[model samples]
Target: MTTAIAGRIEIVSDAICPWCWIGKAHLDGALELLAAEGLAFGLGWLPFQLNPDMPEGGVDRRAYRTEKFGSWERSQQMDAQVADAGRVAGVEFRHDRMARTPNTVEAHRLIRLAGVDGVQHATMDRVFRAYFNEGQDIGDRAVLGALGREAGMAAPTLEAFAAGDAARAEVVAESRALAQAGINGVPSVLLDRHLLFSGAMPAERMADGIRRAVAILRDRAA
Candidate 1:
C-alpha cells in the first residue's frame, strides 16, 4: 500500500494562546509519528493576534484574565485545564509564573523576520517559552532581542527591527484578514488554503486530517 502525500499545512496561531501551544505539541507528535511511518508533509506558521490593540508595555496577566474572563476563579479553572493538557503533550506550562501578556505585534514581526532566515519556527518556540514558561514580557525589546538571539538572529538586527515600526502594519492587516475570514480564535489549521480545522485536535485526528487533505490534493492533480 502506498502512503498518501499532501501539500503543506498552514497553521494560524498566536503565541499567547495556551491551546495553540498544545495544538503545536500535538502536531509535532503527529509529524513524528508520520515520519516514523515514512510519511512526509510540510508545515508553515502564520500570524494571529488575540489582542491586536494591546499596549506595548502590556497588562498584568491577572488583571487581563479578570477583565477578559470575568473572575480569577474562572480564569484559574481554565488555566488548570490547559496546564493538565499541556503536561500530557509534554509541555511544562508555568502559568502562575507569567506576569503580563503584551501586545504581540512585535512578536509577530519577529516571526516574519524569522521566515526570512528560515528560523520562524525556532523563534516562535522561544517566544512561547519565554512568555508562558519564563514569565518574560514579550513586548519588551530586550526580551525579544534575547529570544531572537536564541533563534540564531543577530542581536543588533533584532534590536533595530524591534525598536522600529517595521511589520506593524502587515501584522494588523493579517489580523484583519483573519477576522474577515471568520477566524475568531487561534490554532486554526488550514490545509491547501481551503480546508479549515479550528481548535486543538489530537495527534491521530490531525494526522487523519492530513491524510484526507493529501487525498484531496492527489485527486485534484489527477
Candidate 2:
C-alpha cells in the first residue's frame, strides 16, 4: 500500500514579483526540511498578475517603477531592500540588469500550460529566473515560448499554445477572481486550497505552518 501524502502546496504568485520568487525559495527550503520529517506533498503554481492593467508589450522598468512608486530614488530603495532580503534567502536579484517591467499575463498563461504538461514548477522557476535574474522580456511570446521549451515542453506545442488564446482568458479571470477574494498580494501560499499565509516568510515559519496544516489534515482523516 502507498503512504498518504501530507497535502498539496499551492503558491499563487506573479512571474515578475521578486518577493514571490523569494517566497518560493523559502518554501523550497521548507519542503526539504519537511522531507526529513517524512512528510510529502504535491506542489503547484498558480497565476496572479502584479500589473494586471499593464499595457501589452510592457514598458521601461525604471520609468514604470519610478512612476508607480513616486520616484526613481524610491524605486531603487525598494529594489535595494528586496536585494538584501534575497541575499539572505540565497537568491541573487539583479535589478540593474532589468530593463523592461513586463506585463506578466502571457507568462502566467505559459505557467498554466506547464501545469498541463506536468512541468509547472520547473517552468515557473525558469520564468522567475529569466525575469528577475537575467532580465529577459518574458512579456514577449517568443521569449516565453523559448523558456517553455527549455523547461521540457515541446517547441511546436508550447509555441502554438503561446500564439493562441487557450489559457489567456482563464488566466486573466482566475487572477481577477483571486483579487476579488481579498488576496490583494502575490506569494500567497495555500495548503489544501485554504490560505496558509501571505507574503515572503522565513523557511522555519513556513515549515511550522505546514506542520500545523498537515496535523489538521491528519486529524480530519482520522
Candidate 3:
C-alpha cells in the first residue's frame, strides 16, 4: 500500500502567515494527489517567528503594521494581495477580524508539545484556522487550550503548555538556529533535509517538484 517515493517533508512556516496557509493547502493537495498515484510522505512543521521582538502578550496589529510598512495604505495593499491569494487557495482569510498581531511564541510552544502528543499537524491546522478564520488570539493560553481540545490533544498535555513550563527553550533554540541558517521565509519546504523550494507554489508544481526530488534521491541511492 506504500510507495518508494515516500520521504520526509519539513515545512518551515508560521501559523500567522497567509502565504504559509496557502502553501500548506497546495502541498496537502499535492500529497493527496500523489498518494493516489503511489507516492507518500511524512510531514513535519517547524517554527519561525515573523515578529520575534513582539512582547509576550502582543501588540495592536494596526500600530505594528503602520510602523513596519510606513503607512496604513501600504499595509492594506499587502493584506488585499494576501486575501486575493487566499481566495485562489480556498482560504477564507478574515483579516478584518484580527485586531492584534500575536507574539506567536506561545503558539509555537503549543505546536511543539502537540508533536509529542502525535497531533502536531492537526494542532497546526487548528491554530491557523483559529487565527485566520475565527479571529482567535492564538497567543493566549486559553485560546491555545481550546485549540488543543479541538485538535484532540489530551487534557494534561494542553494544561502543560498552558503553564509555560514545557518546550520553551527547545522552541527558542530551534527558531534561532533556523534563522541563523538563513531560513527567513515561510512556506519553505525541505525534502529529505534538502531545500526543495519556497513560496506558495501551485499544487501541480509541487507534485512535479516532489517527483523530481524522488528521482534525484533514487539516483543518489544507485
Q: Among these predicted structures, which one has the highest lDDT?
A: 2
Which residue pairs overlap in candidate 1's backbone? none
Q: lDDT of model 1 at residue 17?
A: 90
Worst 10 residues of 1 by lDDT: 1-10
How does model 1 score by TM-score?
0.91
Deviation from truth (RMSD, Å), model 3:
1.4
lDDT of candidate 3 over 1-222, digit per residue (tens): 656547898889887888988898888888888888888888788888888888989889899999999998999999999889888878888888998899888888888899877888788888988898888998888988899889989988988887756988888888888889989888899998888998999998998998899889989989
Query: By lDDT, highest first, what's the ranking?
Result: 2, 3, 1
Question: TM-score, each model?
Answer: 0.91, 0.95, 0.95
- On the 0 to 100 scale, the lDDT of residue 69 in model 3 is 98
Residue 11's lDDT in candidate 3: 89
lDDT of each: 0.81, 0.89, 0.87
lDDT of 2 at 133: 90
Report the alpha-carbon TM-score of model 2 versus the true structure.
Answer: 0.95
lDDT of 1 by residue, 31-57 (tens): 777766667666667889888788878
On a 0 to 1 TM-score scale, where does candidate 3 land against the true structure?
0.95
